[model samples]
Target: MVRRVGESVEARLDAERERIALWLPVALGAGIAAWFALPTRTHWIGLLLVLGAGALAGLLIGWQRRFGRAVVVGCAVMALGLLLVWGRALWVSAPVLALPVVTEFSASVESVEPLPAKDQVRLIVRPLKRPDLPPRLRITAAGEQGKGIAPGEAIGLRARLMPPPTASLPGGYDFAQRAWFDRIGAVGTVLGDIGRAPGAGDGVQTLRARLSDHIHGQIDGSAGGIAAALVAGDRGAISEADEEAMRRSGLAHLLSISGLHVTAVVTFAMLIAMSLLALSRRLALAGYVLPLAAAVAALAGGGYTLLAGAEVPTLRSFIAALLVLIAFLLGREALTLRLVAAGALIVLIWRPESLAGPSFQLSFAAITAIVALHESRAMQRFMARREEPWVFRLGRGVAGLVITGLAVEVALAPIALFHFHKAGLYGALANVVAIPLTTFVIMPAEALALLFDSVGLGAPFWWVAEQALNGLIWLAHSVAEAPGAVATLPVFPPWGFGLAIFGGIWLLLWRTRWRWAGAVPLVLGMAVLLAQPRPDVLITGDGKHIAAAQPDGSYALLRERAGDYVRDAVAEAAGIDAPLAALTDLDHVACNRDFCRWTQDGRTILAARGRDRIEGADMAAACAAADVVISERWLPRECAGRWLTIDRDTLPQTGGLALYLGERPRAVTALGAGDEHMWRRPPQVSGNDEAVPTTSLAR
Candidate 1:
């Protein structure tokens, strides 16, 4: 009996050994993602320990190869992944201004995009002489000041430049980190920008801008906007209302140029090229027909990538499409997990920071799930069954679409809740109608429009594309208007998301019955979603705006009609569904011209506007009555005792603050909770004389 048990264990271990190579890249990717998700940036000492330990273990395993070779290899690969991500982080961690600076400067516009607002444009600029600064800056211009500015046109302007804003709350979206990877050092508004400078040069951005302009000119209104979005990836032309409707209906992905669009364009190009070649007997009989078709498809995908601005998502899709095309040319199955792994590995090697983004996570998750479903035994058996009647085939197609939509939605639900705190409940129903229209009619027409526009014959194709888009838009609006179409949830904690991702990868990658173990972490992640805590008090990054949680589970703004963005962030963090416009009911708030006061947990909190109003008797009274005093200006020394005081000096380092009121109240700040990395400015060491009396509750 003991010998039989030993034989069974050894057999299971050998079977697992055969699958280790397939799991290596996924494990490596998880390691890289884990590194980026750290609360504080890793130092060289920790990295050295990881690498050295992994190497030592690998060497020992090689010496005793009968037992743990797979484990050793996984450790080595994970360590290597961590090393690569750390190296990428260091490479991209260039510094921006620590404080906001108002300066006059000249830069060449690399690209110009219209904002959602009327008469506003955002210019991506390259600095001419400032090597110390970031490679690019995003500048906002109003009125006609930047109307006709094309890419590669030098413009001189006065602007107030600052580092991209940090996360509004701890573990919230880190715009600063994103800007760092994007090579944008600063973001500013152009005060006055009509002057043309001397130096400018043409680039890919120039070509894309020209193409976008031509597309916009050829089409008009919402139809034109959708056409431009499809052809040039200029989504800014679409109205916010339309965008919102699409999001609510779960059709927003159609607006972005991604895997589906790239696949459609490449497939259409290959089909068209093959058809034309087949028409000519000489070309059809040629030995290189397959290679020629592959090349055409590759070129088509590459051209579309260039038109779409080659952003991270587009680049990833292009790489994946190219890999699939290569596999097809090599007479191998195209949509295998190996191909996806190769594509993912290549993208991570090129830009490890992308692993931290929602687009990268959600896109890859959906793709992996769909591909896994296709390769499942049940799906394969269903596909291999005897031919069915026409009606049965049609029903099967509908069922396939619904299944694909469900798989993708289920795979991406955790990611959506983590990033955006919402999910579209009617996405599958909307996609049932929307995907066919987009894949068959809209995308094909847009491809034809692109081809025709090069020869100044695009009007008819644009019209056809517009008609398809009109149907899609109507469907989106109708679906979004339905009750319970969108479901909002609270943001999941980082660890919960991490666990969910691991479980998802386990389920998708494993090929054995043991894969069901993934359900454990998946369930735990769902529990975490229900267990997440809400903040009692929230403050804006600028320290000028504040919101406090009320007894009824809604947030009340200290000042009305100000800091809508901050209010929204706070509300989302707290899982509150209150509208920004409806947060003006100040019945619970006591306010005068200079100060406003609110109470929570039997503690009075004071928000003062000016230093003059916080002096002498009023100051003493505020300190005596309030548990926390927040002010825009510096406060006096006598007002610091049992209570906490936050003012201008402390606010700069904090960014934003969240206070938890209990028996022993605590607080956390955005900066205090964030990773101390090279991209961020270190917190200042205040002198004793200037130090404020406040306790940091950052964990």
Candidate 2:
């Protein structure tokens, strides 16, 4: 019986060998993820690459066992990925600013993005006179200060600048890492009058910028902004309210120039190319028009990508589209798992840091799941039926769209929740209308409008495009405003998210019944999320904001006027749906001019919000009396608490903290001890740092 079981297990493993190569990218991504997970930098590229090469050499030197070879090759690929990211990190390293600066400086503009709504233009400038500053800086200029600032122009201006900011909270968006990769060490805001902004932003000088400006000149309101986004990838003109609606309705993807937009542009280019080339009977008879059409489509799509800012998502889509066109020319199958993996590998090799971003995750996961579904036998059979009635074919197409949308949503749930703390409850249904409208109507019309503008016959097309965009905007707002449009749920912990992603990859890649095993981990991940508990108290890096849990199960803010970003972050972490309430409004907490004190479940939390209003000795006595103490200013050395005490001296190392209350209380911090990443600049401590609980801090 044991021999039979071993043979069955071997047979099952052997049957899954066809997809062994597909897991190579998964391994590569894992290696890159491991690099990011480390608290400090690793410079072992040569060692990792050597290990990978040695493994390959071992496989050639009489190591012929199939399972051993598979394991060796997987490890080898992972090592290569780690090596690539390590090298990339070193290549992109730049000095970051340590303090805020307010000085007049001159710089040559490298790029400009006009923002009509805010009456501002963002500039990426190369510093010419400031050797003390980083090589590059990203600054936002007012409409008056940036009246005609364009690329290639040298300009002088006074601005206040600061270093790229770290994450506002644990698992929150970290802009510092992105800035490091982009070589931007400072973010600045121009100092000027808040006068009327340039109307529709007419100062841009590049072709893409000019086109975007002209579109805004032609159309009005949010319609013009939508049109500009489609053509030039400038979203600054879009109103924040409309942008929020798009996000809430899950239609925001349409605003980004990704797969849908690229595919549409390529198809349109191919049709126009074939039509023009087919005018020659010689080309058609020689069977050369299709290949030429593919070439034309690739060129056109590449140009559009450059014009659209070449963001990560657009680049991914462009690379994928270019591959599909090449496959057409070579008479090879398109839309395979290998194709998806190839695109991902190229992206990872180009910018490994993108692996941590939501755009990269969402785009790749959506495409991978869609490709796997299409390649399934059931979907293939459904597509193969050719003798059906027109009605049946139409019905099948609609059903396929709905199914694909739903599948993509399911595949993205963990990632979405992990990042946003909410997912659209009815996004699949919303996309059924929005995708077609954007793809078949708005994009085509916009292209026509641009194509005809040289001959002055484009106004009609522009009008039609505007009307369609208005309808799309209306649909998004309606869906976003409806009841239960979004589901607020607890975001997954890092481990849970990793587990779900692993299971998803397993389910998608393996082409056998045993693939059902993947569902076990998926279920386990969901269970972890459902059982996760909310942190009882929250504090920001600056020690200016705090959130405490009240008896009524609501989160109350220490500051009555907390910004939306802080409030929402606290609310999400607390697993509450409502906005945060003012801590003063809670009856359990007692407040004075100096500090506030609250007692709950046999524990006391004392917070010092006003330093000028209290004496340090008195504050220390108050802290000693409470079980927990939180201070905005530096805590007195003798004021250690019964359970935990945190203040200005430790806030730099902690970055942010989330405290739990109970008999066995714990504290979780955003930044880990001894983290030496370029972005984390926690102050040095000479063995005097407070010792946080290892078990809680590890999480």
Q: Judging by TM-score against the true structure, name the best candidate.
A: 2
| C-alpha RMSD for every candidate | 6.5, 7.0
Cα error, candidate 1, residue 655 (Å): 2.5
lDDT string for model 1 (1-699, tens) is 955864564565566564545676776776687676554654444754776686677576463542346556666777777778878767766556556776665677887887533567898888655544466888888857777677877667777787788887655688888887776778888775456643432223466667766767766666667777777788867776788789878888888889988988899989888877677777777756677888998998999899889888898999999999999988899998888888888888788778888888888988899999999988877666567898888888788889889989889878877887777888987899988898898877877888887898877988888888888889989988898877666544678887887888878877777778898998788778768666777777677777777777777666666655676577666666565433235676777667777777877888875435546555776666788888767777766425678887788788677877878887777775455665675222111222222111100
Which consecutive 10 residues in model 2 have the weakest lDDT in total?
A: 689-698
Hey, what RMSD does candidate 1 come out at? Answer: 6.5
Q: Quick one: best lDDT, which candidate?
A: 2
Candidate 2 per-residue lDDT, tens place, 640-699, comes to 788988888888788777777788887777777887665675221121112322121112
- The CA lDDT at 147 in model 1 is 72
